[model samples]
Target: MHPVLFKIGSFELASYGLMTALGYAMAAFYLLPRLKKINLDRDTFWNLIFIAFMGALIGAKLLFIIVSWPQLGATTAEKIANIFRDFRYGFVFFGGMIVSVFSLIFYMKKKGLAVFKTSDFLITALPLGHALGRIGCFLAGCCYGRPTDMPWGVTFTDPHALVAPELLGVPLHPTQLYEAGGNLVLFFILHKLYNKPHKNGMILLAYISCYAFMRFIIEFFRGDYRGAFIFGLSPSQTISLLTALAAGALWIYLQKKETKNG
Candidate 1:
């Protein structure tokens, strides 16, 4: 359970951060081949992807910070200081998704990439990249699940685990694995759909709808406090519902647009 994967002199490399970087590197490798297959301009795609990558990283951190803020807060200085103390932890996946997608859509507009079409292109990358990110989460032991007695459950004795020693020796759902499995399934579906003659944004619409639904289910097992319960569901659940609705609406609208064109 080495949370610190290794050290280079004074610099300690965290398994969490290193794995996340590897995930994106894998994403670039996978995405380039797909883009070339579709005849997208590699140079422009690379440059834009880099911007999207930066946006995703910053957005992920910002989202994590926001979710973890209540614990660190009262004043701006308090919040800023908290970041210095625990920056390597506390990132919320949904928050990063929101910011990263917004940045991508905005960048697409700037580059004259059709919003829907570009979104379709991104669908494949999103899930693949995200699955890798969740792998990093598992290594870091941050977004872990509650204690359980299931046969296949995992035990994180590492001090890195958000779970305490009292909670150790007990089995717990590997919520990170749950998310990674879901995202990988989503990657397969989106990649399969990418080649079909669906409408421009159908794949994205499908991915959003599917991933939102999946995340809502997975969040139940997470031990971290995610804000309040609106009608018994946590804040993340409520947001997932909204995203699901939006995805469904987008899918319907795309279907209608395709119909009209036909």
Candidate 2:
């Protein structure tokens, strides 16, 4: 509810940004030790992190613009202008994931690093950071849930909340917290899987499968402005379905390959 976390002389700090920074910082802290364990050079590891971060930011914003294009404006000029005007807000997590993965792969290859091995380390840290980002979503009141009469339903009355004007003060499902909890659980699962012996891409596939499923289910409760629905499924849900199928296929392929080699 406290979107503006604090204020100083003519300056205000946002909870969403703070939480996101904290999440990234924590992820970096977790990653450093893992990188050392994997024998990746510290300087190279930091460079990869920087590249992934930039890619994630750009991808998140770009996907948001594409998805929300219909609502941007009536004319092409206005739509283009709107993108720049509203640049500070709006992001899609899946877009960030896809772009970050590509960025990581490209950078690893360019640097002559082991891509899959490095990815195993990175994927394990992703959910922990994502969980904090969801907490930011909750505080900012974006990514809100549908109205619910359940006892645990939450009401957002803050004028600055990202909840739609109509839904302000109305009880909703608190879906942000739900996703945050799910991501935290996913982090633990991936961490454990990392410790145990497994196929190279298993942890990454596991993350995709678990996250896509969680996101697909959570989308059912989301009431915010999700753009473009087809066959009664939101854009995110559609992507989730595709991602889940792809992950399953990849999992099967990896397992078979491992068996053949064994």
Candidate 3:
């Protein structure tokens, strides 16, 4: 809908960037106090977040370039030029998630922190931030939904919007909001889980399982050009399947271990 949130004399503020920043701010606000309560070093926690953020930025852009390479241009020079032009608005969430996890793990180890407990503390904020990011996607008209006749279908009329040019003005499913809503719900559920005394890695496992399932279902309604498909499933969906399975197995193992110790 409203892609440009505001404009100054020559400079324009994008709704997507604003919303994403708000999400980060909100997550930080929620996290800082919790870090103190949990006895985690505030400096270490903030450092980990910064590292994850940088890693996510790089990974998301790298994956986007890799997946969209062929479509960038027909010639080498054209492709190189297109890279600079297209750098503004493309990212894959899974790529960011993958890289951020590895980065956080390495950082935690380097700092001599308890990895699982630190991850559990940090991950509770993820869905909350992710929900806002999805709303940003909605406003920016990226990650749009498939065509639909439903009354809730949204039409993107802004010429500056990122929705595919051909799909402009067409009624679409509003998949961004769908995921946003799902993530909000997930945030609350994870918050409750975090408050309760649970296994060390339960929160992380829960997030993975819940988000994987949500992403898998939501992929069906996604209309945007999301990378390649393998065996009739989109890249995200394939990753979701594997992530869900792995998380479920780990969750079970953790539960058994806790029970044995108890």
Candidate 4:
């Protein structure tokens, strides 16, 4: 896979960065017209997205650094240096999602916005954006998968790719594309669910539950170093389990509340 989309002299455009930007843009486009239906203004929505974006970047980076500290370098100084040098890559999606969701909740409360209602709209667009971002990960050779003899396994030959040297040219299970495809399917499911009458936070709950399940399964295929394991499960899988349980509890509570109100 090509990490550098294009390079001219000293200018290099990374496929990961480019796809990430496109993901944000795509999410924005999907959310814009629907904001009015939720009674949210463009300026305020933009500000909220900015806040979430900053929070996501910080949270994702911090989690990545913490989890990958041992693998960063041999010495403390090398680790610190590598952290800054490779800051552009190594992001944990769950970390970003946790921070960004909290950031949005805080902003919505301060702005007196209907948190659940607005989140329903935003959550529906998440998978759409995330799908594209995974494509970027595939191209950049980050978030790679374990060795596989499957016919569809991908081999990364590009030196610029972020795949480990030992994995280079080896057939790997293309986990990035697997997640991307799953996200695309989830996006459609969520979008369809969003259009139907439901509870305030049902869409959000559905996203959390479905994505956690998907991520939990996908973790098995992932070959990259995923933080420390808890109960023989990777960090993402642990979070996925916790998140899925939380979403299930919330769904049950919401359903009971709806039934009682009715």
Candidate 5:
């Protein structure tokens, strides 16, 4: 896994950035077809996606920087400079997901589009595209797991894995692959659920619940000292807990409504 996909005489295209762009393109393309099923306007859908894309990037970076503030042995100015110097590093997926969803909802509302159903449309793409992006994470070695002695453990031998071999070469849990597989399964579940009659946004709720559960579990396997994990609960895990609870409550409410109406 090469972090820098390639270089052109001082300009390097990072695999992380490349994967992010590819993931968004895939997600947007997938949503285009599903948006029709949800009866959302094509133009509105595109606009909303654009807004969500920017929101996700900014939110993810902001949250990552905030959470990593303790580890920054650098000043605020240096950290700011680093972001400009290397845009490929540091992004928090859950932060981006939450921000993107809310921002897109706001955008769609301003456009007079159906926010709930469009949110559901995004669910179908979220896991699939997230899985693709994790493949990038595996290549880029940003969200790595803890050291391990498992036979199937992986070594960050690839330069794209970012961190040095001294810090990363030990046999480690392939958390990225684990997550990519988890997301793939979630994608299929959402895809099938979409075919059934459930309230709009229920699929998205389901995604949040499922993904949060997995992320919470996976945090235990990560060796790096994310503040969330440092205190025995990673920020992602705490957020996951909240997201799961909210999604569960919403799902139950929707189910009761359908039952009463039926």
Candidate 6:
């Protein structure tokens, strides 16, 4: 794993940050031209994207700080300093998604955009971007996997890598790549589903359900200290369960509404 993509003098470029930017650019490329189809102006869309990005960054970092408090530092001042000391790592995807979705909804309502329609379009491109972001996580050695005896297990040797010190040079499950591959597959599935005529919120529902299911399974292989477990399930697993159930309920309600209108 290479945390620093390159360095010149005292300055260094982080692979995680660079890849994240690339991911966002790729997603925007996929979405921008289609703005006309959704009747959204470029300026409004850019503003919405910026707001979502800020919300996601703050939410994800806050969740990470909450869950990884102990590892951060012993004192409040130390913890605060630690947060700014290394801004490259620490993020929870679900936290970002949840806050970003709410931010987008608020912006859409303020802008008089069709919530479900715009959301569906946006959701379709999220997985494609997320897929690349996972690759960044892999390269940065954050969100690493549990120790494994599997033949495909990966070992981290870079001192700059963010993996746990004890886990260095040990073969781990490569959970990051697993998720990257899964998200790529999900992007295709969601893209195909988006092209077909469906309910206004169906694409978004599908993403929530499918990703929740996938993340639930992936959590089993995660090595990091996930926050307090509820009923023996990790925090993300609990969130995934709730998210999936919520998506199901929403799907059922939408179906009933459609049927009633019919």
The candidate that wins on lDDT is 4
Q: Using Cα atoms with residue i matched to residue i, what is each candidate's TM-score against the true structure?
A: 0.91, 0.94, 0.94, 0.97, 0.91, 0.97
Report residue 233 deviation for candidate 1 (angstroms). 2.3
lDDT of 4 by residue, 1-262 (tens): 8899888998889998888888888988998988877888889989987887788788888888878889999999999999888567989988898899898999899999888898998889889889999999999999999999999999999988999999999999999999999999999999899989987999999999999999999999999998767778988999999999899898888889889999
In model 3, where do residues sit more than 4 Å from their true spots? Answer: 252-262
Each model's lDDT: 0.79, 0.88, 0.88, 0.90, 0.80, 0.89
The lDDT of model 6 is: 0.89
Q: Any residue pairs clashing in model 6, and if so which?
A: none
Clashes of 2: 0
Which candidate, 1 or 2, has the higher lDDT?
Answer: 2
lDDT of 3 by residue, 180-215 (tens): 999999999999999999878989998999999999
lDDT of 2 by residue, 230-257 (tens): 8889888998998999998988888888
- Error of model 5, residue 55, in angstroms: 1.1
lDDT of 4 at 181: 99
Kindly report the root-mean-square deviation of model 5 from the true structure over all alpha carbons.
2.1
Error of 4 at 70 (Å): 0.9
lDDT of 1: 0.79
What are the candidates' C-alpha RMSDs? Answer: 2.0, 1.6, 1.6, 1.2, 2.1, 1.1
lDDT by residue for model 5 (19-83), tens: 87888888788777666576777777777778878888888988888888877546888777776
Query: Where does the lowest 10-residue lDDT sum fall in candidate 4?
Result: 226-235
Model 5, runs deviating above 4 Å: 158-160, 229-231, 255-262
